[model samples]
Target chain A: MHNTLLTTHYPQLTTQQKNTMNKIQILVIGRDADILQAVVRLVNKNEHWNATGTSEDESAIELFHQHSYELVLLGGGIASDSELKLRKIFTLQNPDIKIIQHWGGGSGLLKNEIQSALENNEGGNFNIVDNPFN
Target chain B: MANTVLHKADTRGDANHGWLHSKHTFSFANYYNPERMHFGVLRVLNDDTVAGGKGFGTHPHDNMEIISIPLEGDLEHKDSMGNVAVIKNGEIQVMSAGTGIQHSEYNKSNNSTVKFLQIWVFPNKKNVTPRYDQIPLNLEDRKNKLQQILSPNPDDAGVWIHQNAWFHIANFDKGITTEYQFKAKGNGLYVFNLKGDLTVDGQLLNTRDGFGIWDTDKVQITAETDAEFLLMEVPMAM
Candidate 1:
């Protein structure tokens, strides 16, 4: 698997302001190729968000350690135990990062989840709740 | 005259990842065939069986009409729209990924496999607010006759999708004959035999066989044996 990154930049800003305007990074994890591609395309549509998806646990973990991601979207392809372990690792590394589990649905629900997560991050609130469906 | 094409069941791409077994009628995921990319507006037709207690995790879709028809066992569905339901054998589910949506499906049973057909069609109306609907299958009305299960009309008899396509399912006894005319002039029909044997437009089809026809008014189907099938009519010009 080659590393493919879709990056966005904003011009006409000061050096520090330009850094602040860099697109929000989102890490998506799932085993389904179609789902991964959809996530990347959906995240890139906003231009304010950049997403990278990988099915491999090691790859996702490595990516998390290498970059500062504001959120992580976990796909249903992973087991419950694995999801928890990954969530623990992600929060431990960055307390501000928001993680949400996605069961299959439509894009509207996905955007809502992302919005909720972003709001939680902005509020500086860190609370993990058990997903009733899980 | 109708332009006809036969897409045999065996020629479909197969993906088996232990917990899930899927067969794709058109290009999907890692399976890409340029010539077999789509059947007009019909983008994907995947026959899938998920292992008990396992399923697809949350996924995103937009600008597509997605449908699910369970053939065996039960499938648990959850979406970002706050819909959580179980679709069984006698039901049909549709989701319009208009602006965007996220959802997941898992087999609810721990001891049995859940088999279902997943379909995707390009929406004629784009970027509308996403919606979801599931309807109960009327088993009594479909015996030896075509039963309309999905259509573009919101007020129609069946569930509505965001595309100008129609879907019908039927269970025919042996020696039964039926005719299905296209609902729209420029639409093409994809006939998929779910079980038994049948003759469609003078072509014999066995279990899982698929036949696509366009440029015609109607197609004749004669059941050589007890047969169950799904018929989908979608626009060819989209």
Candidate 2:
């Protein structure tokens, strides 16, 4: 994967000390071309998610490590497995940071695995998918 | 004087017809309050729950962006656009109600209660063809984190809205802090704590409580404990 990010450091946010910006900063990682394209289209509609960057480049890890973000989305296939990728995420990202790993097609945590882990991992906050939107 | 925005999550106009119970986040047509017309482009947020073997009959809408998020059960949807789909738990669905369209949704389960959220946003562009899209969010994406669920541009994953708003859902771990930045210029974030406790803009927000700040570009949110929250950033001078 080419390092498109190396040439461009996260744009130096204008130094103006204007009022605090309320946009939600996000970092998305994945290989699904359609999904990444969809994000570009969607961000055009939502003025709230100030999307910082979307990467299919294997350099997603370095990009995430070097920048400061509010949320990060790990698209499917970025890594081989879940546990290994998750560990890498926590190690480099801020302790209070947010991340979402979109398992591309199928493979990763099983349903039971997620259910069981939810209880302990969430620290008692359960908004577990209780409904569906169609 | 404008009417007060009747946005209390609990003190809402409700309709329960056995099969479903819906609470209007803001005033609806028949339940109108002049002041409650809207808070920016955030027109409607109806908290709906459907009973087993029951759901909404086919309905028609136009010139809006409709998003349905099932919080509890499964949702079976059929649209006049020849679209048949099911949005199960953890799924985020969006329909551009442009150029008018008709659709029906039902609870696909037999003995389970279905709870969901219906949020409406004003469109940036008018009269585009009606369209539909859905995405199944993964457990890892939302596990102990806030997921970007809605954006105006449709560039990232998840669903797209037609307006200058973004909706993010997250399940925060104990003592985790998250940050948010607005996409549009001159916009700000309004933090809504759905469950648990949260501190945004340095103020504590309990379940169902919301605090909004405008004229700012970015804000920080820290969870005192495990929590679920939604952040809405919209233009203030609209």
Candidate 3:
């Protein structure tokens, strides 16, 4: 049933490709809807990357459990208490998941942060370039 | 039988960056191994050597329990918390980066290298007020016996962090044997052989080897030579 669902949804992907297919999934949580959506869009612009944004803690937790997210981006405007609780919950569920606190930064810096984190996890060199997206 | 995992010294990831050379016993910066990401709540174990007058620049960390044990030379530390200090051999340092903190460390000497162990453990609490502590250790106290160095209680022997973990170090003569009992029911123990040969739960380990065991209350360790090692007891579940 799972294979059938995958084939139906992704008809162009061969069995070998499907078996090796791995997308970088990110969960973006913030209090501001506009910035959250913008961040999601920016992340989606990267190839093989997918992001889902939510403004509510409950919804974020639900989405987290529903998807196998490798990273969580905690955007600005979240209360310290909420951030703490969310971090605890997320870590409890996935001990290896990387949680990044995203303060106010331009798209270039944001992208670099995400890239650095992913590369760091994959044992690659972490290099921060100045405004590559610009 | 106790569950166990072994990591030989040569299998560790090595990085050489001119001024610094480091070996990662587990996944660390530029040394990711999916299967070796961590052993329970015990995250990072880095054996590092810094060239004289050179060290890590200012960097930020948050929500981690960072501990350092200097083996040789002197390491000068400066942090945003307005604390500056030098830690040498026979000392341990710990920083609880609760909310966030920035710190830097450099070798204090101009001609001698500084060797140390940098370890990171997952804190049980979040958003804790950041704090730092370091203490000099009595080297003679660890001869042929375990000397507690770090624990969850600040009032205890060594520095404390925001985690349910205990760390101990010992130097033993050949033919000496000892048994270590777990502090907490669900906690596991990671044994790191600093020098010389040893056997833990019947597994032979040489210098720089790492052994992790759990699901048992106690284990026996025997020194095959005059040996020094560290024992880290941490929760098996996060």
Which structure among the candidates has the greatest TM-score?
3
TM-score of chain B of 2: 0.89
Worst 10 residues of 1 chain B by lDDT: B28-37
**Share of the reference A-B contacts seen in candidate 3:** 0.00
DockQ of each: 0.07, 0.01, 0.06
User: Which segments of model 1 are wrong by more than 4 Å?
Assistant: A1-38, A41-134
Q: What's candidate 1's DockQ score?
A: 0.07
Give the winner by TM-score: 2 or 3.
3
Candidate 3 per-residue lDDT, tens place, A27-55, comes to 88765454565577777777677677777
Name the regions of candidate 2 deviating beyond 4 angstroms: A1-134, B1-8
Which docking category, incorrect, acceptable, medium or high, applies to candidate 3?
A: incorrect
DockQ-sorted candidate list, best first: 1, 3, 2
Q: What are the per-residue Cα lDDT tens digits for candidate 3 across B1-238?
A: 6899999999998989989999989766556566675687787899999999999877655556889999999999999899999999999999987656778899999899999999988777655777999999999999999999999987999899888999999999999999999999999999999999999999999999999999999989999999999999999886
Better of 1 and 2 by TM-score: 1
List candidate 3 stretches off by more than 4 Å. A1-71, A75-134
Per residue, candidate 1 scores C-alpha lDDT tens digits across B110-134 of 9899999999887766456889999
User: Deviation in angstroms for B156 in model 3?
Assistant: 1.4
